[model samples]
Target: MGTPELALQVEPARWLGAPAPGGLALPPARAGRGTLYAPRGVYLDDRVVVVADSGNHRVLLWYGWPKADHQPADVVLGHTEFEAEGPGLLHLPTAVALVEGRLLVADAWHHRILVWDDLPEGSGQPPDRVIGQPDLRSTVPNAGGSPGPAGFYWPYGFTYVHGWFYVADTGNRRVLGWRGVPEGLRPADLVLGQPDAYSGAENRGRGVGADTFRWPHALVGDEMTLYVADAGNHRVLGFTPPPEQDRPADLVLGQEDFDRDFELPHVPQGPQRLRFPYGVALCRDYLAVADTANNRVLLFPGPPRRGVYLPAAHVIGQANFAESGENRWRAVGWDTLCWPYGVWGYQDLLAVADSGNNRVMIWRLRRS
Candidate 1:
């Protein structure tokens, strides 16, 4: 049989930020206006939309689902005023999610994660807690490069799964886990890609391997499975029942094997490979990967089994799996994407953080 293809519903039905596509600019961060720049992370549900407005050093929260284009946000974090990008502010906020009524943000460049316990009552409120550093004012990696259990350098993204908090500590080239929300400089409950918690080595100090990682950027999974976007390695690694310690992934995507780090030679470059796959979302039988550098999203009608190089069943943002050019050699539009970094799927809605274009595109999946 031939590869499956998905039919999206009538182009992108809605966008959350920026009226038009534009490059990075430092303007007064405003809601429902053309102010977002290089937005890298986004999460939404039936009631709320949260964006890691990275370029502005802040996070924007829209309490209700946006009914129209460019809807104003209900809350903002990291600045007392929209124009300020000062100390104690979010430095390159790259991830955002709600955990137990609290808002968590991966403040990437600051080398820490910030948490708002009660989801900020209004714009510019301070965070209730901090992780990876002694306090909110400190931006040091592992607190002056000490490299211990709590030190993190460039933590890009995270996910809460099976009652554990997992962080893709990108700079450290590992993923850290905690049984609960971390408070201050505490040791992680589990560590992956390093010999021990104190060691920060690229690919676990052994170079490339199925069990090692280089720039593991994003994570999403559940109790039965785990997926990590190992960006630098140019593959997505999957683990069954979630590994508790350093172990090899059972499934590998975008490469011929887990030991292979380079993209396979496909004359037209197809769905069986990936180029800097940055974001992933899986719900039930559905899976979506933001093949970032290739400028498209790959969709699988069902999750691939362990130890198999199953090709993606469908392609989004491009006409087919064979073409990998930015925006499929077309202008940036609702039907096209450029360097999308984060994606989330729930029910029938799929949201993509189209980073290069600085917008969030929402699509309704159609099975036919």
Candidate 2:
């Protein structure tokens, strides 16, 4: 199919990045500059919590799940300044996950992970424990002079599955696993992707094939398997707990091979491919891929195939937004999407991080 022409109209519902006082903003719907690069994941709530990593170098917290509704996360994490810092300070946080009763943050650029134990606190004030970059720093400005597990290099997404914590080390171009640190501090238990780098200047990006990754942005995992949003490579890599104890992705999804294409990377299949897939989530038997480049969400029925890419069992985006890549992905309802960078399913709500468009869209996800 060729690129679809966009028919939907673009409208501004609200403004963000306003000088919110007391972490609150209402009335006069403040306008955001523009969602050009709002890299964020979803919060576990009926409310759509966004890590609008505004240009301010701070995560802009907004809450409003059903769209028509309006409310914002009463809390904010990171420094009030437009610069990244240590401890409570965050820099370009791309992913946020709720682990146990606390919040887990992948403070990208700062090269570290922060655990906020103060549940429901207005903002992530002083995390109970800070991992990566013992000095506590963001991804940018590596001037902190820290080491790898010693510090993170652009950790993008975060997820706590089964009994472990996973981080998408974007700069390093790999995923790091750690035993879920309930107390004290957990160390990196395993490293996925090019675990070995020749030097500090090289990104560890190696795998069986295309699924190895280019710039890993987000990830999702359950009890037994791990799924990766190999953003730069435009594919999803899957793997089981390694028997060799090395995090080698055993399966693949999206395209047929690593060669860049608007399609998902995998081996050439009878028919199937993805384009710039950014976020991923598994709902029941369905594995959802936010094909970011195409501005659509493609759903696979049987999950990842080690070799071939599967045609979408369902799709949302221009297909639902008038068949145009103009506005990215948008699910005004279920089974629809656009330029969506994040997707998550829990309970009956499916939360999507509609990155470029500046809003997280929610939909009812059901099994047939």
Candidate 3:
């Protein structure tokens, strides 16, 4: 469930997969909350799914929702505070995905990546393929130095894009890549910030500010563009296809035009601005921003029909939800939403990683 232990360090995400109107039995009032803090990113397909329960020091696999919470997760990928097992376990599992028929985990705290072929089969807990630390050490781990394919440091976010894997190595201040992924999980081919950073101070050595990202947190890529929640930059940076060396971001949001500072906060006209944006995704053409600090999910409408060109339209929760301050949880029309950190597009429904309030919130998105 959503525990204060994890919250203080990682901010847990709520399981928003809803129960049938009058069907599934509700768990004990206390058991339904969430077990994440800064529960950052999520991914799903068919009957299998994964979550980066970051602060919790684990990754949870479900046989899909509705059936998810009720059943014990099909897999537990790390060493939880209370549970003991696995490949010495994970320090902070920030993101997860099933890639090329294999499981992928951004074992953030351990400074590496872990892979599994089955949900909870072989080894029961030990990862078959690991990328970060070679041995096991619990307290504040280190990557030694330059991550040579099998290494990473505070790799905060991850996703499988076009058979390749892209990682936001937060502590290292870079977006490291495993071109052809699952196949090339070693040695990053592309690096955004610096590489395999070992010290906190050195993280920003590359440069801080809008132009050069500091802590590039989460990522989401579409057919034509790649969107990054460039946390330190205080803006979302985008790049058109044909991404190349130092390929510039095509657009910026949260703050006014790039390179220029926003007179106010990043959340346009809202109660709180985004202090840290942890996750992002493209639902059709709409862009979803999990404005974590502000405790809200922001949406920018997708492009119009081929001929129509209505550019730059934004939408938060319900219009009635006040756009100011920290009361987003109690906003008139909101009814729900708390420290929401990550999001993914699911057909008509949007699966949200509602980190703080302790539950995933799925809303049926609509355009009018």
Candidate 4:
């Protein structure tokens, strides 16, 4: 099969978190005018666009589609200023999700998830609740250095769908789910990567298998399917109908089979391989993945409708799959990417968290 021909390009020259925006400019010594540093999380809906400004230890919220580059965000979370980084503030927050009038943040380094009921109107407001730890001041994994249903270590990303809440507990090599939005450190009703909720071992402290995960970093889905970017395992796992309890995934991408976790050692680079796929997004008939270490994003014309190996129909950042260099070994531009880690697609718009570039690139799919 020929390389899939789904063409995409940057939508606007105005990039979010850029320095031109007011109030959060980085110091002169820094590389860019914007304050973002290694940002890894992004969420977009009809009302707003939210980004986990990881390096700044803050989150930026834009109330609507930005009409120009360097537009200022409407709200800031975790700190009053962008340059400040401290405890009791977000530490490498990697994901953001808003549901049911509440804002959710995966404060990864703090080993907790923070909740804000009714989005804050400005900066420096504290969250209404904290999950994974007993309180906002405690950063201990599992709240005291042991694994249980309520604790988390480096929770990287999350999603809320159909009244259920999910988190990619990266450091623990698992995924946790709640029947609804969690109010506190309530025990997860569902767990993946181990036999039960209490186990936090890598790959369940066993060899690689179809049922285990090394680093499950992101979650995205609709009403019928849930996709996980299993970063450490270099693959994407798909669960049809979205598992309500611990169960084996029905579909796998980036490898020939569930047991094969190694990257392809040969000539061509194509859909059959993935190197640290850190994010996934599914739209009507499209699937996009942030192939992070590979410095590219892979796009499929349609999600796997069955359990089969389907090659990527298109690619972004690099001319083709065989090339995997940051900015394709050239100066960074709107068309290029470096270590891109998050993807959000809604309707015709697709947003990419271009981490190494310190900017979010929005693209629109070209109609055939």
User: Which candidate model has the greater TM-score, 3 or 4?
Assistant: 4
lDDT of 2 by residue, 1-368 (tens): 21223221222233322221221121122223222234456655544354545233445455444233334444555654323433346656667766776667666656666677745444445666776654443334222543344346777776777887777767766676777653323446666665443122223432335325577788887766778888776577777642224545665666665444344323322224566777888765667778776666666655554444546655655443224353422223322333578777665555666655445565555432
Query: Worst 10-residue stretch by lDDT in candidate 4?
Result: 20-29
Misplaced by over 4 Å in model 1 are 1-11, 21-32, 83-88, 264-267
Among the numbered candidates, top lDDT falls to 1
TM-scores of the models, in the order given: 0.91, 0.73, 0.74, 0.90
Over all chains combined, what TM-score does candidate 3 have?
Answer: 0.74
Tell me how far the alpha carbon of residue 172 in candidate 4 is from the true structure, in angstroms, after superposition.
1.4
Residues 119-214 of candidate 4 have per-residue lDDT tens digits of 778777888888888877788787886778989989998888677788899888999999887765788988977898778887888866667899
Query: What are the runs in model 4 whose C-alpha is more than 4 Å off?
Result: 1-14, 19-33, 86-88, 264-268
lDDT of 3 by residue, 1-368 (tens): 11232221112122433231221222122221234444566776566656666555566666655443324455555653224423357666666777677777777767767777666542237767666555444324344655444456687777666655677767656666666663323455665544333234333454444335666788887556667777766567676651434445566666655553343453345522345677787765567777665656666555211111122344344333235334343431223455667777755456676555434455555432
- Best candidate, TM-score: 1
Tens digit per residue, CA lDDT, model 1, 1-368: 12444443424777776665333332233433345667889888777888887767778888867888766667778776655554348888987888888888999998999988876778888888898888888997777875678879999989888888889999888999888778888889889878888777888777787888898999988777788999999888888878777778888888888777886443576767888888988743667888898888887555764875678877778877777776666566667787899888777778888877767888777655
Model 4 residue 16 CA deviation (Å) reads 2.0
Worst ten in a row by lDDT for model 1: 23-32
- Kindly report which residue stretches of model 2 are placed more than 4 angstroms away from their true locations once superposed: 1-39, 46-56, 59-68, 79-88, 137-147, 182-187, 195-211, 241-244, 258-271, 305-307, 320-324, 328-338
The local lDDT score (0 to 100) that residue 213 gets in candidate 1 is 86
Sorted on TM-score, highest at the top, how do the candidates line up?
Answer: 1, 4, 3, 2
